[model samples]
Target chain A: MKATGAYEPIFAGERRKRLDDVFTCYPTKRAALLPALWIVQQTHGWISDEAMTEVGQVLGVTAAYVKGVVTFYTMYHQHPVGRHFIQVCTTTPCNLCGAEGVVEAILEHTGCGDLGATSADGRFTVIEVECLGACGFPTAVMVDDDFIEGVTVDGVPELLGRYP
Target chain B: MGYPHEPHPKETLILSKHFGDAGARSYDGWVKCGGYQALKRALAMDPADVIEIVKESGLRGRGGAGFPTGLKWSFMPKERRKPHYLCCNADESEPGTFKDREIMRWTPHALIEGCAIAQHAIQAEVCYIYIRGEFTEPIAIMQAALDEAYREGVLGGNAMGTNRRIDMYIHRGAGAYICGEETALMNSIEGRRGNPRIRPPFPAQQGVFGMPTTINNVETLVSVLPVLNEGAEWYKDLSLGNPKSTGTKLFSVCGHVRKPGNYEVTMGFPLGELVNDLCGGMRDGRTLKACIPGGSSVPILNREETEACLLDYEGCVEQGTMLGSGGVIVFDDSADMVYQIMRLARFYAHESCAQCTQCREGTAWTVRILERILRGEGEMKDLDLLLDLSEQMTGKTICVLSDSCAAPIVSGIKKFRDEFEAYITGAKQPVAALT
Candidate 1:
């Protein structure tokens, strides 16, 4: 493999120690892959090909294998996203409670234009997610770590305002 | 207790007695509420005797499959050559289900105690509570509770001052609904893609790390505490004369209801009363039209069927649906059945691991056909195509996900054919946008 540009490694010094700490929780080193990827995602908003390679090297798994696990789950971002990532629930239960309209409202307010795309300002990226498991409070939206429930079309603007 | 509301008089609260109580989440608070006494008592008894008590209680798996909880534990070999494992499935990603989230959030110690009890019963040293990534608050709360438990000697090398070793850890799932499946969950823990494996050697035989494992739902494991304390006969008697289904279940009611939250009721509770009285009925003057009594996977029930239904495994089966996870989704007269069913198909399509051809192509095509109908671009032939496609999707995949996707499609077409016809006939306006 040839190096394209300067690629900073994630697991080093204190970061490597953190990965080792995660390793103690699991019986196998391969079981630390999920937590390892989470550490990468927390440090860097998205996972790049280089980061996958680094994770594979540290966990003794292949890069292709790491990518396979990453792509299988929807939470990991392959590319960079906006500062505030918003995921609105639009499953059957949420849809019955006008969740689609909330999605439209979120797009219109965030200026993200569509689902899975970030706004030109790079401040917001809104996407539709399947059930955030807070269906009792319908139209649950997750802005980063904040799980806001019972959101309505009118609440989109106020919700986005607080995020900014 | 109905989480966001006060406890109803009709409710039989055992596992959910401390749902909204913040104090119950702490280690000391849990002991104050009589928590670890069950674990202490169980650790002294023979593991076989513990399994027998649970079996006598008639507790079934709360996570969709109504398998006997004790029978699942008893499957573990008496002489454990390899390590035994216990996995508590906290991945509550089913569309209408949010009860497990509450269980971890408010009553974290209850789940911890339950897992400890289950670990001893199954002869497992380590228990992994697999929680989904989206539950950030519950994860934080549960992690803090675990730390406190370790500090207080509730869980450690010598758990509860006993000679046995008991260790518990939280394994966070990234974002996959299919990981809620038992086999798929084991695969996920092994750092593999979340796909359901073909089972010949089930989890109990060859499971996570190739060890004997017994996986129980968050609710099922937590119920063990009450059963141990109050006795299995008392727990069994909580049922409304339903010998097959015992104990109270937490029904996470959502959509088109007055009070949308988690409600705990005894087995064989009246579904209509749960909706009308407990949930405050269909949100003021809005008439109920349809309901998915179980989670999103089960067949949808029409108004009359929903009213006639009972909140139990056998009762739900009698009404042409299964009590899956007890995630009751209500729909009112204003809801468009065609559009809602399309949304459900899209969820299954998104969540499919795509390991099987039927699920991969079938879920995608199901969504496409449903979208066409919702867009009013479908013909009468499309419905037949959907029915035919659904037949192929069911019972063909390694997992029931494909069949789950087909349940509502087949049931919706059968019970609410007029809704589909209205969209095709241009009697109803197109609601879904074409991508």
Candidate 2:
């Protein structure tokens, strides 16, 4: 079957070699699927259908199977997200510590206007996430790869400045 | 030790002694602090002996289940037919739990050393520390520590110069709360969707590529090093005379507390004292109204239960909850019980894997019901309907995700019915906007 879109392959050259090396850790070739998908997300910021097909091809699984795994996880963006995707923990623990106000402050400061919507500048995308596993440090936020803890509504502006 | 703060005089620091010290993050610094001594000692002793010593220490899993750590280890096959796997469960996504994160962030070497000892005890050549991807810093810190361990011959073909071959790797998980479950964790490591598998041929018999596998919580394994080093009796005596719940457990205190952080205290410590004295009670003039002593999955505790509660396994059980993961979430009188309960419901509804029909339907419906109650649209009939839905949701799924959704709802209704009734009766204002 011909490829669906103009998707540049992620697992090629050195990246392909890295993916191949990951296979050594697991007994089955299929076991490297999560790492393979992560490599795609890290490189492309989202997993397009064509990229899912490509990952399926590499892992000897169907495109539907790859998409199935991709959609199951919250971190993997199916569509293109902002350059900096910020997930704020607003669960019960964080909520008790005024996480909602922090979310509101982030949505306002990031110019995203709403949760999950990218700002007009395409600089930020903010969303309320479940627990980020740092409950003791309430109102934890993750701006891309950075896991920041003890974030407050008052500090959202200063924090966003550091991000951009 | 209450991390990010001074250790309380009452705290018994076993696994969290080097929490705030940045030097303890590296292998050399850890070595200077007498770090790998437990692993060195374990390498000399028989793996069976190591397992026996841990079993006698009365150490239990800290990942919410409270399963006996040593008992879980002994379940692995005595005669290893296939490659046995040891998975260190570092996927700490529980809403109120953060102790494991501290262990990984600060004492990376201690965890690696613990994994090394565990790998030896379980007769597994390979150990995979499955960490959640959200923990970028902990992952980087642990990866550096693992790299240092390999360079220093602590984890490799000939780990610590021992003839036994042990290889430890990090399998990063994409965001999935269900992946914290042991079976789901194995499925995730296998590059599949993180779905919980049914038990019958449990992980001990067939797990992770259909081999004998032993999965343990981060706190559970790290505590093993101390058990082997200090002898089982000393470790057992660390608890306040609780034979069932030995050793000092790290309780992550958050929410309305004046001082919130990971507090390490001996078993049988009073929950009231930990909240009032150690955590400095509620903020300002607020009084304690509610608490979830364990992770968010457990039942909520009322003020009376909160004050009289013990911090041990049996003590929590007596109060109609479990000392699960030791993540104490405090709530002051200002907290809205009905709305907060709805938020908890929403978390489970969002996290459900949807494999089990009950969890998929029950969690979503529970959230809807709770949201309806929070929106002042609920009637008294809806309360019983919520109870009925919760009853059906419990113990009817492949995993406890559905049961977890039901726990807070059922407990909240039983203990704090007045709050739910007020929402239904329109006495309490609708706080949450319609979704």
Q: Which residues of candidate 2, in runs, are more than 4 Å off?
A: A1-6
In terms of lDDT, the poorest run of 10 residues in model 2 chain B is B426-435
CAPRI grade, predicted model 1: high
Model 1 agreement with the true structure over B97-125: per-residue lDDT tens digits: 99999999999999999999999988999
Model 2 per-residue lDDT tens digits across residues B195-253: 99999889999999999999999998889888987999999999887899999899999
lDDT of 1: 0.92
Worst 10 residues of 1 chain B by lDDT: B426-435
- Alpha carbon lDDT at B284, candidate 2: 87
**DockQ, prediction 2:** 0.88
**TM-score (chain B only), all candidates:** 0.99, 0.99
lDDT (C-alpha) at residue B58 in model 1: 99
